[model samples]
Target: MGARGQGRPVAVIGAGAVGTSVASALARAGRPVTVCGASRRIERIEVTEDGSTETWPVAQATVPDDITGYDTAVLAVKAHQTDAAAAWLKAVSAPGTTVLVAQNGVEQRERVAPHTDGAYVVPAVVYLNAERTAPGRATLRRVGRWDLVLPDEAPARALAAELSAGLMRVGLEADFATVAWAKLLGNITANPLTALTGRRVDVLRDPGIGTVARLITDEAVRVARAEGAALSAAHAREVLAWLENAPEGATTSMLQDRIAGRPLEYDALTGAVVRAAERHGIDVPVNRLILALTSAIHPGQ
Candidate 1:
């Protein structure tokens, strides 16, 4: 709806909640959206919230051959699934293609760009509370907004305008690393803690759990600073408080993975901090413990 790109298509790869909602956003903007899932199990993408449902009848592409022309492909799969996107990336990504990497943590461009050559890859931090119930049905559990934060760049500006035309709010970030790491701090506690205890974000409100959660953020802040992320140690306390006040029924993607018997992204979220801390000679024992404990539960190896 922003600019009719001369017949160039926009594809959302992965049928997960984030990807589904993004496709819905584009569809609501009067864009003909293409959805490429792991399989062709879905015929419709339903986004529901507060007893209201918005359904999009999308063109389904389960394999590379089923996919058509596209200029932008939003990589909405988990970090671990980036490897799985290699085939699809090679098929749809042409010269001048822009792939939006929408996933948790940082280094998204590093993981996704290599699979497709001659494409401008962008990284975006997504804020959403949606979960897939059926193959095509995703429940927008929280009645909030969907948003994307991207570095201030030419392509990112275009993407922001395009998504903002629909049901999304876009923010431009001059210091993208800090914004990304700051969001990562918000994830470290809820992700690992919920996955371990099999509880929702409500666990963070407990006095004892809240203390440990804050400590994890504190350590992650040290790692973020060492990486020149421009995050404040004070923000660590804020992250803990924010989680404590979040919706009681909210759950992280990592927790969803554990509950669904899928692979957890501990390596990308908390484990990322530990790896960065080791490289910078910083001590992050709190992160190390949670990472170790999470790995014990989900050895994704």
Candidate 2:
């Protein structure tokens, strides 16, 4: 099936870097697409992946009512913006529709299910490193091979087929919990550390900071295993290594939010790990401290 999902319309919520990139991919695949809640009204979306650029014309809708008959909605808003984007969720979540949540953190279903009107929620582990350069422009800085990881379910498989276009490669994993938790492990450490220090990806190479990151990841690994995510100490080390080797001068979403003076997404990233640790009676001093400090810096959360 196409991105329209058997000829039904498809909509992308949020016009941030990730949203625009996905929209560009779908449009490039000859799928009928619409973008809702764009930061600005634009007729085109431009995404530069690696060193190549692709542009596609898209229908832009500012209000939920303007978009109807959408069978698939790719939600790309930040964790903190979920509540604010609830209206768009309701609009596209017609009965039996699928909402593909392309956000950070592992609690994508929990965070989004409440807002949808009984629509099927498919959580996606997004691996794309996209940055919005302007209103309708984004750059996909390649950090890994795949762009998304979803559960090995019918909805996910269908969604993956529709999204296999351009640079948007998708993977279906039988053990999605492990994949989600592993991705969270990287974000739980890298995002907060960079935001707090006002530094780029290379800051993780500092000895003292590296030690703190390891501690945070170690604690999170315990939480992940407790939550049945098959994580180990070796995985923690791998997370640190991946971040340390990321392109120099690369900024995390949390660091970008700090620079823009917007609310940080620590609650969903670090805060989620802390919450799970509490349930399992696990002591997560590093993660808890990082959560506290990052929470203080966020605007409203």
Candidate 3:
């Protein structure tokens, strides 16, 4: 079925960088899409990706109630802003709504499930490096395939098929928890460290920062394993290696939020690791320190 069986009505909430990129790509592909929520009244979108820039018209950005019809609502807001998306959820989501949560961390389903009752909550590991230059205008510096982890349901398979045929590549994963936590292990450390340092990910090239990253990730991986994610120390090291070798100026979402003076996602990323570790009787001292530092500095919390 297409967009909850209504056929081709896709609403992408939170017209930030990632949301704008996803909506622009879908609409440009003649997929009948809308870019909405907490954004200016955008008549069109300008996107730059893969050495090419394209502009596409879309339904003007609007509130949730303004969505006359929609089958798929992609929740692309920051994890901490689920409350905002909750209101939008009630506006556009129906019993058959498919809510694709494109956010950081492993708590996508938990964060969004309470709002969109009876909807298919699919957690996606987003791997795109798109930046919002202005409202309704975004630049995709790099693009990576989105991985959707969902139950082997017909709707999920159908949605996966639809998204895969866009400017964005998409794949389906059978073991979502493993994938989510593994992604989180990489996200949790880099975001907080980058936000704290106000620097790009390559700062991990420093031995001191790299050691802190490993120590924190080591504890986080233990908690992930306790929570049945099957993450290992080697996996944590691999994540660190990736960060160390990241492009010189590559920044994380948390770092961008800090730079832009927006509320940081402390609770969702690092805070989630700390809370999970507690449940497993594991210690995450480094993560705790990083969380406290970032929280103390983030004015909007």
Candidate 4:
């Protein structure tokens, strides 16, 4: 079915930067889209791309009970916020629905499967670099080739075809575990350090910080390989280079959460690496230290 074939609205959970951007893209492509969030009233979602901002008058539903229908849904909340978003997931997901988990970490399927009733949950690796400047507003800073990467499966292929008309592009990969782990390497390296230092992507330019980032990448690469992802030692350097080359002053989701005093998502990024390392009996001192420091910053969250 195409964008308008089934007459079913596409639900995007979480009004954060990623969610707003995805909703805006799909809406611009003429797909019926509903943005379900925590807002008490309908809000105009705006996304700025290539110096131009556009507002989408998509359907809005804030309450979980109000989100009772949708054939496809994107769960864009942070890993730590999964519990809070469970109600919406349950309301929109059923046997025929397709729920795409667009959050961080390598455990997207495991993290979101329980929340979605009988709907097929597709794990996605989001490659977009956008930030929620304010409520209902997000700016896309990078002009990347694809916004999401998914496995080469029937569900993922169908979702990719659905999004083909939008600004968001989806790539189907045969080895999705490797792709997810590669992205996770970027997260575990950039996120924890940036949140801890209260800096942006440029912080990796510092020699000391760069050293720590490499150490973190090395550990994560090892853990990712152990977890059946095809990552190499050279991939560590490539991940660091990618982070260092990001747009100047670009902020990560973890850094944004830190600035807002919200709970850090280190448990998903750094915590994922550490957990895998423990299971494989690998030594990852730097990753363990970063996880501890980030978790302490927002204790009990």
Q: Please, what is the TM-score per model? A: 0.93, 0.94, 0.91, 0.94
Q: Please list the C-alpha lDDT of all candidates, in the order they appear.
A: 0.80, 0.84, 0.76, 0.84
Q: Where in model 1 is the C-alpha error above 4 Å?
A: 1-8, 141-146, 299-301
Give per-residue CA lDDT, model 3, range 1-301, as digits (tens): 3434323768878888888777765665556667775546777778876567888777754556776457787788899888977778777666777777888888887888778877778777776666777887777765223433454556767766666566466666777787778778878878888888878888788888888888888889889998999778888887777667664466788888888889998898888898888898988888898888877985543
Q: Which residue pairs in candidate 3 collide? A: none
Give per-residue CA lDDT, model 1, range 1-301, as digits (tens): 2333533467778879888877777777766777785565666789987779989777777777665456778888999888987888877677767888889997787787778787788898776777888776787654224367888999888877777777577788899999899889988888889889888888998888888988898888888998999888777876676677776577788888888888888888987898899999999998999988988885442
User: Which residue ranges in model 4 land beyond 4 Å of their true spot?
Assistant: 1-7, 299-301
CA lDDT of 247 in candidate 4? 79
**Model 4, clash count?**
0
Candidates arranged by lDDT, highest first? 2, 4, 1, 3
Residue-level lDDT of model 2, residues 6-55, one tens digit each, is 44557888778888877776776666668887767788888886688878
TM-score of structure candidate 4: 0.94
Clashing pairs in 4: none
